[model samples]
Target: MVATVVQMTESKTQIQHTHRVFENQKKAFRNNPMPSSSERKENLKRLKRALLANQDRLLEAIDRDFSCRSKDESLIAEVMPSIQGINYTLKNLDSWMKPSKRHVSVLFQPASNKVHYQPKGVVGVIVPWNYPLYLAVGPLVASLAAGNRTMVKMSEFTPHTSSLFKEIIEGMFPEDLVSVITGEADVAADFSRRPFDHLLFTGSTSVGKLVMRAAAENLTPVTLELGGKSPAVVSPDVPLSDAAQRIAFGKAINAGQTCVAPDYVLCPEDRVQAFVDEFRAQASTMYPSLRDNDDYTAIINERQYDRLQSYLEDARAKGAEVIEINPANENMKDGTRKIPLTLVLNATEDMKVMQDEIFGPILPIVTYTDLDDAIHYINERPRPLALYFFGYDRAQQEHIIDQTHSGGMCINDALMHVAQDDLPFGGVGDSGMGHYHGKEGFMTFSHQRAIFSKQKFNSGKFVYAPHGTAAHKMIYKLFIR
Candidate 1:
């Protein structure tokens, strides 16, 4: 019995080792300081090579974790984006690394001003389960490019992929440069509480708050990629088939687990039925059945599946017409707990589906009388992470862009806004706090230190010593005026 007890305790101890791993990484970063530009570029190159070499393994791991994540989807969404991000960083790293010169006023003519980009020591990246590899490596690539050491805490939901990634990292890089931590939420909480120089969290809003509060204890700066009820506005001018096909594809990808997925659709009252019909036809062609369709992905786990079910039930209870385009039995033996590509008509603002970020395959269609009404509806809510507008009318597109505030916007497309490395990705207000990806990611991880150099000749000494003199008064008046 004592031996069994000892074994159990040891197992628990091993399970809680993520914190220790983080501490070790922190110490390593402190010892080495910031890496040079060459080092940063080399590390990124190694990462790219590793990813290219083990592409098949990485896809398999993600598929295993997500149950039915397609190879094409994983490659397109995760691998390609990561590679593109790396290439973008590599091309601009030299310019990004250079010190930026600042203009000096005549009053301080003797001083030269500039800003230096410095690494913020070690950065902690807390990744979410969906798109685990992309989230983990994407931030890691940016942190490395910014000359900062990184400590990554992979989501426990993707254990197999996380473990494989950890193994890959151990083989390629030194632990002092990059370390991987994996465990349950307790370990994640503990990891978040650590005193890292910077922390970037990609997860839900509730969890983002916890991470923020924890980082506050250390006064650590954070970048939060949280979720919100991102909307897709279909103007009367765009073709119904095009709008429907784009929205349906975006909502169905990864079973709508994407943070930037179109949560709801806002269409003109007269075109609601036409939009619904087109959406149904497109969804049917894309996914014939929720159960055995290889293109469709299952919910991450049973809890999320049930949460989606609850939303559907709530909408139905409130007299909303719920339409399932490709309905399948919830109980199936093939490990596909597929929720239908559903549309809820007559969904009111007070309904549960509209109240929060619907992070599943359900799309709520709300009808609006005019463009102003649609804009008003979006503006009333907390700004979303992404706002998608489908229309060929340039004036209407610009109107939506000008009236609302979202982290990003895409015209005539859904979720494709995030595909551009040139654009910054994040949220505003309740959605999230900071932006990352491409150049923004580098800036997030770096500290732009304002530096000023004074020349030998004391040009501004007159203003420094005598405050009440007439000459000082004249100088001050001239400068101030």
Candidate 2:
């Protein structure tokens, strides 16, 4: 009872703080609605500097949150990308801010048309627990580059990291320019409901629906970076070792707690065993041992750990072959929340692992008789955020590219597509919607206001009124024809 009362009070306080910070940012944005390109670049540079200065602190906090998060993984996945994304934005902000010239029709001669990229007043970024630093910093970089004040909602599950992030950000940026909100689910829900010029959410698709629905109350635009069953297809002719090595790396990174991680593999029926063998060899080589491996990352929490364990049980009960690649074969029930890289063979649609996004080290191997069958299998399901195809055959590659639909693709690799600064990352259909990264990200947070101006001329007046004048007739004949 006392604990409940205290929890309620804390929730109330967090909500109040979130609301106050939001209003302050709105007011600050009103005062300087469009920051110059140099100002935006400076903001980005400050963010990068802060991240670098506190790199060790941020990494330690993330490690504490996950209980056993790998520092090397944190540096590679979180810190490096966050800094690189900021640098990318800095390099391109000037060009991205420039107004785009558009063609003016003859009917409106002596008039100029262009689109001014105006900053949206404020942006709301909801970060997920996995890859907290990168997810939060990626969108924040884009929002700042677009000249918008931002308020970020960090995942409650990552308390140590979230609190540290809030401290670091608040120490450098004023609350009116940048703020971080942290709390449990209720606070996240409240954060989603707040009115903002734009909101970007990164998490599960199920939760994305709730966020989108909340944003709709204010008709707030959103860029959702949700996850789905992203698959990697191994071509019949491609070397199984090469494909398996890349797929293993992608799945092994962050222990497969990545949105774009290869959730499953589509291989030819004849090569299923070979692919599995190669994957096991590669994954085992990377970690060598799971129990005390500093390189291996544990699942984020107990709840997530239990959820992944249940997936293995469900798959086993459904007759899927559960292969645990425990190189050292040590017991993992030591409260570390680490699960060995397990492969589920002959996964069925009825199983939970096949139905939902497997955001862990469990990779399901679904074999197909032919390439057409593989393409058909993918097309039959909801479009994935990313699809990876392995093979150098130009014709086969083009065929897959032409046949299927996904938010993004890696022809001979996996997860590397997102690291490229110039490419726009997003999803379609159930995977997600809207893009952010590169120019698309800047545009996503900016209002492309179309402008048409004319000086000392009124070409449009010819078609204004009075039963269509001769000028209007001539214009219609010229344009309508």
Candidate 3:
């Protein structure tokens, strides 16, 4: 009873600190409402340098957080993208910040219309556990590029990485400009409730709804990067081996914890066995061995592990064919929390694996008779964060593009669309909303303040007051007609 009381007291104290930091960031943003391009560039440079300098330490922290996080996977999924995102922002910051000269109507002859992009005071980033570093740093890069003060709330599930991230951020930035907050779920709830100018959350759809609800208290605008069951469609004519290899790579990367990972595959009905065989071959080639293998990553924790295990159990009980691809056939029942790249065949909608976002290395293969059936299948469900189609036919590609909606898409590839620096990444409908990479990201964290200036003429006054004057009538005749 005493321990529970102490825990509550500590949580309250931490919430108070989080609130104080938020207010400080707001005050600081108000003081320096607009930061120069050079200042923002320097901030990006400092962040990149910090990440590079502490590369090994960050990877180690992540490895510790996820008991068997692959070092190569961390580099590929986390560090490289973060550095590239910063570089991309720095290179484009000046152009993005330039005031857009809008066309002034002929009636307003003496006035000029322009849109000046200004920082949206304080931005709150709620990072998810999977790919923690990249998610946190990616949004931070966008926020800094837009010259906004930022506070990142790291996930408690990744405690080791979160603690180290806080320490590194504290050393590099003053709390008023950039702060990293770390704690449990309650702390996250409190942080989301704070009145940030804008909030970006990367997590599950259910939690995203809660975050959006909290942000609504302050009428805070949000950019949600929520997860849904992203699908990979294999064209009837496409080579089964090619599609299977790419889908396997996407689903196996970071143990399928990616928000944009291929959650399921839709293949030709006759080719299901061939595609499954090819996927197993490709996965086996990638890892070769799962038990004590350094390249294959384990599930994040026991909770996630149990959840995935239950998914398999439920699917099997509901008559889905489970194919476990353990390359070496090693005993995996140990406490390593590693599950082989398992494939689910004949997945029905009622099964847990088919119904939920399978955020693990479990790929469900659903057979479709035609392309429209596949497209219709996707349309019937909630929009996904990403959709991958594997076919060389241009007409089929265009048809798919025109028919469906998703946050992003990759034709003839999977998971690579997110790495492109020029493309905007986001979700549609149930998957998520709002773009946050490339130019869209800069706009997302900025407020476009419209400005109208007049030097010596008062043309607007001609139609200002009098109801039926000659000047007003003349103005109305010119414009209304």
Candidate 4:
């Protein structure tokens, strides 16, 4: 049909335009391969100011996109962290930019070595829908701090947020410096295929594979912040009530739609009942009534709501006990897409809820016999983005820390390590790879090129290509060891 052909042509035109913008950014980067420290700082400060000024609009836009996103959650999770990351980047720019000096070996006497951090020209960032603002802004902070021009692709799931984000980005920066592109899956595909020095994507694991595959064609480096079944372990020694309360808080925020939110809780077999009871009580205290409560965020949309509902149904049909904790017992049918904090107890590996990442208000509590049993269970599965352990025993904490593999861990806490500005945040193995945040973020977007210099007092060439001599043998003997 003519319509189909027209649509294809439009898509092709958009892809060509994306390439033009990329070339412009690359040209800009070439003009100034290394931006001065003050220039980078000014850009960061301007970004901080833009975020602060548009805080209310951004929150409102996100709220519209999610239908019932909590304003407090937006402030705490999205806006606040982004500003904090910018501030952290600003605070350490000078120290990070200074070239690191390295010692030279005796054979290379009169020569010195140093490592200079330079921008990777243009970086491509693919942002996800959940925490749309933070996901985009976080990588932008890192990319800018490393003095790189960035092109960002926003998710199509959040139209309002995406448009507003594009507006805000354009207001603060020029197209060639920092640009935002709005598009569907095809656009994202085309954007990924375009060559970039480095690309960072934050989303599901399946989609991450496709993005990486596309990037591979261009040999583009990538840093994927993909999600997984990030687990929260309640140690046997820890009181059920305490662990439940902490896990409830982490899961309740953003309605458990967070990548690092405690996906499932590993409770002792005997303490499962107590954990469920405490979680309900704590969730009730946090969200007195889900229907009319602004503090409790609703599921992002009807599709996600239906997906979670199917998960609950599938688990219940498979003989798992479903405990729906509705504090007010309000009729959820009254045009609200809110699902109470439901606990799927006795969940087995066979169920879909256990197999997939539950990015909703559904929490599956898997009972474990003991500490080693819990560790083995986690080890058998693909690695998670985060691991949470609750207990006061220093020795047991050390044991878990030494035994397990995760992107990050927090002893006696859940979702707290991600807030630390000094720590590196990322995943391991199947969860994802590479690190960002703090100095690691700067390094991730930078090229740490080594520079070696020789002075006038350089030593004579001891090992020429001619024949082996006593001096060459002596030099080899002294250095090779």
Clashing pairs in model 4, backbone N/Cα/C closer than 3 A = none
Worst 10 residues of 2 by lDDT: 459-468
Q: Write the per-residue lDDT of candidate 1 for residues 361-386, one digit (tens) a residue.
A: 99999889999999999999888999
Each model's TM-score, in the order given? 0.95, 0.98, 0.98, 0.97
lDDT of each: 0.87, 0.92, 0.92, 0.90
Model 2 lDDT per residue over 1-481, tens place: 9998988899999999999999999999989998998888888888988999999999999999988889999998899888888888888788888899999977779999999999998899999999999999999998999999999999999999999999999988989999999988989999999999999999999999999999999999999989899989999999988999999999988889999999999999999998888988998888898887888999999899999999999999989999999999899998989998899999999999999999999999999999999999999999999999999999999999999999999999999988888899999889899998888899899999999999997877777778567887888788896
How are the candidates ranked when ordered by TM-score, highest leading? 2, 3, 4, 1
lDDT of 4: 0.90
Residue 322 lDDT in model 2? 96
Over 244-271, each residue of candidate 4 has an lDDT whose tens digit, in order, gives 8899999989999988999999888998
lDDT of 2 at 42: 83
Which residue segments of model 3 deviate by more than 4 Å?
Answer: 1-3
Winner on TM-score between 1 and 2 is: 2
Best by TM-score: 2
TM-score between model 4 and native: 0.97
Higher-TM-score candidate among 3 and 4?
A: 3
Residue-pair clashes per prediction, in order, are: 0, 0, 0, 0
